[model samples]
Target: MNEGYRKDIIRYLSVLNNLGGCHIDTINGFLQKPSYIGASPPVSLFPSSDGKSIGDALYQLSIVLERMTDNEFDDTTFYHSKQLKSPLGPEEVRRLNEISLSAKVTQDYMNTIGRVFQSYQLFELLSSLEEQHITLISKALTSIFPMDQSITNDISTSKQKNYQGIIEKIKQLFSRTKIELFLHLREEIEESQKNPHKSSISQATILDTLDIKSSEYYLASALRQLLSTDENSLTTLVNELRKIQPLQITQLSLLPFKDFYQILDLQANFIQMANTYQFFKEDSNSQFNISTASEIKMPSTPEIKIVDQPPDKAIYKRNVKPAPSVSFQGDSKDLDGNYYVSVALLRCNDFSEEPTFLNGASKPTKITNGKIVTFKKLKVMVTSHQQGETLFCFRFDLRRYSSDPETNPNDFEIVSSVHSSPISILSHSTQLKSTAIADLPKVTEVFPLSGPSTGGTRICLLGSNFADTPAIRLKFGNVEIQPEFFSGGTLVCNAPEHPPGTVQIKVSNCQNQWSVTSATFTFEDTNTINPSSNISSDALSNILPESVFGLDFSKTFDTNFIIKGLETASSTLPSSNGAHRNYSKQY
Candidate 1:
């Protein structure tokens, strides 16, 4: 009896597997074949709200089957069902032979069958809960089309008698939108009963229209969707389990053969439907074989832009501070429907040396040609908006790259080539605090106060509190340019081209403060220098000593002597001596 019980459960599960289009393989049946068969149904038989109800049933069945095999379970270690030891009857043998390609599909289906059967408690609860529900739906149906017996049994037996027209009409009614279907059902129930007085059922309010009567019938239609044996029913029996307690699970030893017999009614119903409906009939030519490779199409490349970058100086405390994040926006026109996008970090200046997760971790930072931080790889889905824009924050484990700050000091900027800015990663909060309270730059003098209008004349500015950072900017009059480099107490930068007139020279450290020297720069057209002037090309060339030109002037130089030389040279000038002397004193 136990063997027969097990075999009978297998038979039903097999039928469901075939009907539901579940493809199962050995050991990992559901995992291997995750998709369902056939096109989607216009309406599902099972309520989608009762999510995973059927799958839960299948899983429960797998557990029961696993327990049933007991000592003979070779597949227990694999965590799935194995073939039963029960003697195969002719029907079981025939069904087994029909799908003899592998014994695993039977195992997978058996698991699902066990789950469904195990949920008998929940099913019983549903039945008890829907007692009035069934009556209301029946009443609604009988009012539309008078019947002598229960509408549920009639609908079931109608297929056996080839009464598809009634079923088709019922399907048409259910195919309407939920509101229309519920409202129509409510109307039919109200008209048939004609209760003039207000009862819960007779309430004509709009809110009452969506009450138990309509909702239950809608649920009934969803339940019916699970049994969709046609190709049009894309409804999957998996993932329809609803949570309910008192799931009174029966032991295999206590399980009666009558239970199997009761479930056989479903198989009979399916066979009857197969005989009546063209869709229920299996097509030998139809195959579930998916073509992995078809006509080759070139993949599309999306244009990704980083809309937001990490803060300039992110504090690097192990696990105490939030890791900086970058936001990227991709153009959908080039995405070509591909939703999987990847974003990673790379050293802004050096692509070869990627910021690895932990300083000593074995994982390589490089992926493909681009070196990306192995800390995390961001994969995001493209949205359906008109812009096709989606926001994703790049996050990764905040592991120390090195224990010593000297080895991995935060000088380099980390960025994503897709689009990003250089960000300074400070190892200590004190460094960030120091940066916030950095001293204001004070420029006392700018030597060689005059340069040719063509620009490119390297000038040295004497200043205190100057920092050698990328933020340093030098402005000759209104024209501004970044200095090549800065050292303690001095900054060297080429004067930008301006009109052949004097303009104030200002220096900025980008702290929103500018230090303007009293002296101004005079731009002179070198081509217009008078030949009679003693301010010779040699003197102008010798204006800055070789030590200063070579950037070797770490020692302080006399600003007055340099101004004296320029004044003496200007004294020999034809007409610019007065203007040169005036400019010289300001220094």
Candidate 2:
């Protein structure tokens, strides 16, 4: 019996793995190869939500199968299922296989050690809670579809409490959304029950519509999702379990298989629709072979990585490949295909990416060839978390925030820019605290300011407040080059790579306060070799000027210090040479 149980669970996993991309309501045995020898039903790929739900169930089953195998009770694993080689291309097949492997491992962590051993208790607890929930949902469902059965929230479970209100709220929410499919399924169930014995509807069809492979797996997976969302579901169930005496659990554990299943089926509402077939079918199926029906497309959103300061390179830093740039090109749309207000994380401090968590861990400051921060367009609709005065964006910085005239509007004042409309959050003045907004370091003199374009100049900054403050950073044309040393009224740092021209050298303090110098450093080109120095004396003399013309300074600052030909009254000016073209023009 135990071996059969394990086999049944593994085959269910195979079904999930193969048709995991299909919507939960569409999952049925015909979709899996072994259930019907003929052609299978065409299955559409599930949206991300349903895919996650189905994958999670398979993950849980894999865990149970592994545990049962460790005790040497069964040889069944989804790996041992009989299927031919996959028809999917190599990359898609590889990714699908990896998804299955990763999901099982994730479930291992999700099912905490204590909960894994008490699986049956947790399963029963969740199912009992959900049966009450189903009763409530059925009320909301029937109200929307009055032609269906006369289901009511009035049939409350003994342990259930304060659920009718929840039903009303669910009804209001579902009435506005695409939950029509659910109502239609309920209608289908009601019509099929008119002749219960001769009903053509298969058990798999009803189970799929209820969105479960088995009652235990469905409740378990729903509880997992609820732990992140409706956390009260888990809390309520666990509290009720705590009230149960150990003797009751021991009795439940020792009950005969038939008696236990009978009680289990009685507790669930969907079992009524699937009464013609075993709730947990124990049939061996073909091994794993990925099909083209499920195509797992990679998501557009990048999993950003924080790159540490890399080793210095010869190429321009910005031109070098940078860390990921996070984008939300489609964030404005809500789940219901309606537009809502959106917010972005804006940086205010001259330095970027402040650590949010307790530890100094944060995202990397490095980004592609442009600035790291920008504003994202907001969505219009507001949800609960985004009540009145929605947080359309988060403005952050390593230190203090000062509006940059370059990044701000032309007509806007930098000081008053934060208070403007469209971009809120700067309006609060009561909580503003006085902290270190360091003064911009003054540069009275820059010793050896000039350097080669190759950039190895040892430049000393002689300015006020140039002491070794922890956040002092020197930027030579945007690239922040680290300082070698800093002392009272002095800063020593290396020049960075630049073209053969003067660049604005700026000083930024720990507070992101900055002051700019007008082209303090001049970069000279040193790539040319002097051919005159290498030339021999004879060769040099041949190229030397025959005579020199001196510009007399006697009439200094006068534009008309001219030279004329002597006795030129009847003499002709020098004739044009063979190589020169001369022409007379009438003015």
Candidate 3:
């Protein structure tokens, strides 16, 4: 029963919530934290109240949807006002009015008979639907009423009679819809209890009830349509509806076009508005010419950020995805196998939040390519200690669409979710891709450019932006060499054996970026090595070869020296001409 009830509640909330706040946030908030509405024992119509009842969950859900603003809550509701207090602005008041209706609705559930129909999500859905219908009704009234009769007190007996009759008809239509919903809901409850797995309501069914296709809304529309066709009825209805003053004469007129355009800009559709504007060169219905310049020069194009990929090149469309870990076996001494990566999904308008790094994004935020909201991507590298193996799941948002997609944004979040628990950063990489390199790593020079062909010659390498890389590897020809020391400006590695010719010194970074040194290392051939003819026995006994001596890791070396290590024996030999010269050389 609990499973069935929860599923049904979610189904209801999916239709009701502005941004899935009710479905995702409300219940979780109630269960985990103290109730914002101050529920102590968790009020319920049932005897057993564990505080996790479906009805209680629904109630909390209603509060959440009723509270969401356009920015923090969803992409659609720009200004949220659930916490509105004294000295409110007009916009704040307007936003609060939607939530205030909760009191009016909750009052009906004070008794047992009323509590039977007291599903929080169901009421939330109905209230939101009612608000939507009211807006539609207001628009309909505004378009039909005559400007001249808008302020008139002249109400004919026949017009008054028609008005009263239509009002009653509207009441009956709405009243009947409630009865039908009540009966259908009861049947649904029974079915859901029988099979909890199939307890969900189809999306199409929920949309019909909340949308213009709902019985009462459809009936009201039919009534309006019938009257519009009948000229006399329309004339009387328009005159009567005008007295109610949904739209004024001035509001409909272009007499104050500039002011009206300013007001029009406040709406979401203002950017794409294809409204019929009646413009005249002079004020009194005079024909005007289309404003055109005699000669034209194309203005300089603005710096657009979008770059089209060439036909042969693959497109790089990044999305919020999981971060993966890989074995970072590199020549860089500092690099370890552990790495931290996350995809940031939230777009914050205020970046001054110091405790958390939220970027200040203002109006005209990233809303391109049919994107409904703005999101700031935050990528960071961390150690395993900073980010443990915390398990995380994902959350999704659903958008609403009208019959005419051209006129309305398809990504409208009439239905969306605001989870209390955050979706975790992508911890692992499931999708494999070629390493991305925005910049390449460089190896400027390798000190002591020549070494013995036997290898194990230490060389100091120099460059910049080395530590910035996640991993760095040094290569001597085909063999990947291990680095003894590495930093932003320098790296140390032992040269591997190669042919007597010069071998290129190459460096590769974590992102698969590669760079090579202009200065290459030459392997000194054994054929070039010969004992110095004037070398003494003392020098041979005391001195070691350059190959046998190790380098100072802290310092860099660049000087070149002779290849021969042994000294000549002291046995007597011939003099200067073709001499095996025996010289007294000190060690």
Pick the lDDT winner. 1
lDDT for 44 (candidate 3) = 32
For candidate 1, write residues 1-587 as lDDT tens digits. Answer: 12233423322333333333221111111011111332333222222322444443443333334334322222221122112213445665444323311122233343334343432222232222222332332333333334544433222323322222323333443443353435454455455456655443333333244343554343344323222222222121111112122122111111111133333333344444333322212451142111101111112332222322333454432321222232222333532221222334333322223433223223323222121232222211221121122122232221222233345543222222232333445446676676553445777777666767876665667767765544466777777776644355766655676778888877776434576443477899878976576654456556644443233222212222222234465322222111111111000
| Residue 266 miss distance in model 2 (angstroms) | 27
> So what's the TM-score on candidate 1?
0.23
lDDT of candidate 3 over 130-174, digit per residue (tens): 222323333333333322344333333244333334444444444
Ranking by TM-score: 1, 3, 2
Cα distance off (Å), candidate 1, residue 428: 20
State the lDDT at 276 in candidate 3: 18
- Model 3: lDDT equals 0.33
| lDDT of the structure predicted as candidate 2 | 0.33
lDDT of 1 at 2: 22
Cα RMSD of all models vs. native, in order, equals 29.4, 29.0, 30.0
On TM-score, the stronger of 1 and 3 is 1
TM-score of each candidate structure, all chains considered together: 0.23, 0.21, 0.22
Please tell me which predicted candidate would have the highest TM-score against the true structure: 1
Model 2 stretches astray by more than 4 angstroms: 1-297, 300-433, 436-451, 454-504, 507-522, 525-587
- Total clashing residue pairs per candidate? 24, 14, 12
